[model samples]
Target: MSDHAPESGPRRRLRLRTLLLALPLAGLLLSLLLVLPLRWLAPVTSAFMIAVRLDDEAGRWPEYRWVPYEAISAQLALAVLAGEDQRFAEHHGFDTVEIERALSAADQGSKLRGASTISQQVAKNLFLWSGRSYVRKALEAWFTLLIEACWSKRRILEMHLNLAQYGPRTFGAEAAAQRFFGKPAWDLDAGEAARLAAVLPNPRLYRVEAPNATVRTRERHIRTQMRNLGGTGFLDRLSE
Candidate 1:
């Protein structure tokens, strides 16, 4: 009986170790097979469905459409770059300057500006559940590094454009273009592009056509930024 007890305890310990090792392996496998493919998954467009699940009441997930790095409108890309990440093409996964600035602002009790890069946003939107916790942030960083290491800058931007939240039941530039202007993505002009970029900060609060006074102000500012950045030419350089 004493010998059996010793053997049973050792076996239980070994089983626990095996289970712990298997857990991460399973997660890796699931990521490769399931989460990675989300880049190509059709956008979920049912407002009722999304409202039932997510806390955000105004954003919609659009069908997945992969716009080639070249086919995407340069003006639209430029607007996004100027509005979202001015140093997108140059930075790696993380932007330290922006991070430091945001941290300082947070400490000062000002607006809590997030320093999440497009890649980080992509990682969170595509793979992670939304939360404002240190654990979630660490995971976001890990996935952002993995994505940057595995994918090109162009690919990351392309994915972000296609998967990002636009409006309630609207996702992607193409979907938004069609919904807002009854036009294809390629047809969006600089003004239209700027409006889209403006709403990106908070799409639910801003309408494309009849935007509130604040949204109108933001759109105007984005347009001014776009002009200062040399418009489409800046986006052309992103590929370089």
Candidate 2:
């Protein structure tokens, strides 16, 4: 300090500018580090699963079984796509049409419906916490973009099938199929798959074991939608 001259204002500003420029680059690199390897590596668990385990009152961890995409029933995949995000193969990450519809519904004095695509759900379930905050949303968007860029549509759907909550204290197709239908995920028929897909909006409330009126309605609707989606043939788009 005694030998060196005082830092000039321009030098301080340049340093600040350099740091500002570096921040996003650093973030991108970190994000890539987190996402790239997941292409081949199946995640042992997700952030939502961790939170579920930590918040359990009886020390009972949620059920989760990671079945490879091929091991999971193609019917289940089509069921979820029909029930949750029909445009899964078309959109890169976000479903702009659904977003616009939600925004328009809110403007018309209706409740804001979720427009999250399977890819976005994968990003949120795997990496982020559950929240409705703008900060969380911005992060979700950032991660969604990274995932779409890093992984294919099929990988994104595979992650969703393995990570989404299907019933209370149950996560993933294999776990849900075993818990509810007493069968493996690959053996789940179209009806069972649709029933599981039906409760995805709120698994805690919608009981797969005891389908209430609403759950039954959603199950029927999902089955019909699955048929309209051309059964499992609709999944051919994922391969493209």
Instruction: Report, for every candidate in turn, its global Cα lDDT versus the true structure.
Output: 0.73, 0.91
The candidate that achieves the highest TM-score relative to the unseen native structure: 2
In model 1, residue pairs whose N, Cα or C atoms come closer than 3 Å (at least 3 residues apart or on different chains), thus clashing, are 43-62, 43-63, 43-64, 60-169
Candidate 1, position 42, lDDT: 42
lDDT of 1 by residue, 1-240 (tens): 465435587888999999999999986776566445544554343232344246545444334344554665777887888888888888888999999999899899989888888888887776676669998898778778777766667777877777676676577888778888888788888888888878877776777777888877877888888889876777655542
Per-model TM-score versus the true fold: 0.80, 0.95
- Superposed on all Cα atoms, the candidates' RMSDs to the truth, in angstroms, are 4.0, 1.4
Candidate 2, residues 182-209: lDDT per residue as tens digits?
9999999999899999999999899888
**Model 1: per-residue Cα lDDT at residue 145:** 75
